[model samples]
Target: MSEPFDPARWRPAAFLPERDVRDPALIFAIAVLCFLACLTALGVIAGDRAAHGWSGQLKGEATVIVRARGGETPDAAAARAAETLAGVPGVSEARALEKEKAYDLIRPWLGDVTDLEDLPVPRLVAVSLDRKRPATATVLQEALKAQGVDAVVDDHQIWIKDIRRAAGVVRLSGASIFLLIALAAAAVVAFATRAGLAARRDVVQVLHLAGAEDNQIANLFELRFARVAAISGALGAIAAALTGALLRLIGGGAGITPALPIAWLDLLAVLPCPLLAAIVAVVAARLTARRLIQDL
Candidate 1:
């Protein structure tokens, strides 16, 4: 049976050992960082979507506060203004809100009104802007003035600006955190590579004596650590995907809370984590190995 052994099937052994005792701990640490990074990416996606949604809704609308002039009732004046605005170009729909809605709007500041009927509360006209050609605040004002309606228009420019600013802040914070996590993971891998090189110094010296180049030696460590990081990244990515799936199911498509909505498609972002982790590890390990070897 042994006589049939083929020379063609022979394979050379790796310069580095197949596995190290410290592998489990290193994998665990790197995996944790990958998991956090994946989660951060998902948060950023959800937050950005939420911000765009709120801004889009506000962009397509305008509010008009109408004050009754002369002896006309507030409702009659508001109705007249609505009619006037409805006929204006770029105005999709214009209608006067009920008196109760106006009272509700004021209740936050004035609390419950005892003389609600006596108070001349300004009526609200909600104007839907045309998607293709929206009306400007100046245009709306001019139209209202020409019709002799005393009104003030709020185009939600202030609210939209604030939302966009907050969204930018969120995106910046998430990116910073994700960057820090990646660096920490790289640092851990670099440290492990240095430790490995130190422990294997005798083997490195023997290989050097046998005519191995510094880059050749460094490549061994790079391949070893890259494999470890890839495995860790896969584990972390799978865990993150499962957690995201659970959240999406619980919250439905819109997310659990209105603030953070997780969509199923967002989970796809983790798909590249393994390759990214491997690349980071390869760079970190190569640099650390070469530096240590040179110092030796």
Candidate 2:
């Protein structure tokens, strides 16, 4: 009588007895890929946060520069411009900036200046616009002109656009890198599968002669590679996560805040890298096995 199937003995690994089925090179390649994938995901998350934060902080805000002209002092013109801006319908607040602060703003370009008083530095007025009733740069400039203050208003919209475009480029580059890594990983897994199949060709021929189906043989290799990929990928992902946490801690110790804020929920992006690696391995191995088996 035929023996009944035993659930305990039905593990997929049992079908593949060759030690070469688990390729160390494949595992190492998969681990490296997973590590890079984790980093890419983190970069995308950070870039997105930084872009949104910059936009939120700079939108609807402007700086008004009052130049001294026609016997008018810069400081007096700045004060008048601030008063005029405050009375504008969409302007929430306008404050005249101190000369010392204005000097500091230009210090990076001009270096330390002991005689900043002699420099023809324009006086600055910081303007805040109400979100519900946003003011246009043209209106603010016209209002200052009406008050006899020769001024230029910079809304910083162009700078914000450039920042967002830079973030988008960063995100696109990271995604491209991630995609290349994934494709390379799949290629590695396929190569390893073929190598294993070559090593066990005799066993495969014997099994076929003994009535084993092609899918049965393919399953053996798939399961073996899937397990190795899962283990190696998990190790790499864990290492990457620990490294990221360590960096955050070190940055905090150095009193450097990250440009992009990290929250607990960001872990979701990092946690799936290993699983994606394993799925790639399994699919590649299965496809390679089936194709090779068909040729046999």
Best by lDDT: 1
Residue lDDT tens for model 2, 1-296: 87998998886655567455356776777778677777666666766776677776677689998898887777888888899999998999999999887899899999986888888899899999987777989999888888778889999989979878877887787778777876776666567666766777776777777888888877777787778778767877887777666655666732114575554455566677667666766787777777766767
lDDT of 1 by residue, 1-296 (tens): 55776779978888888988988988898888888888878888887777777777888899999999999999999999899999889999999999999999999999887668788899999999997798988899999999999999999999989988987887788788878876776677667666766777877777877988988987887888889989999888888888888888898867866778888899999999989888878887777767766776
| Clash number by candidate, in order | 0, 0
Candidate 2: segments with Cα more than 4 A from true spot: 1-13, 18-25, 51-57, 68-73, 87-92, 103-121, 129-134, 146-148, 253-264
Clash count in backbone of candidate 1 = 0
Choose the strongest candidate by TM-score: 1
lDDT of each: 0.86, 0.76
- lDDT at 47 for candidate 1? 79
TM, every model:
0.89, 0.78
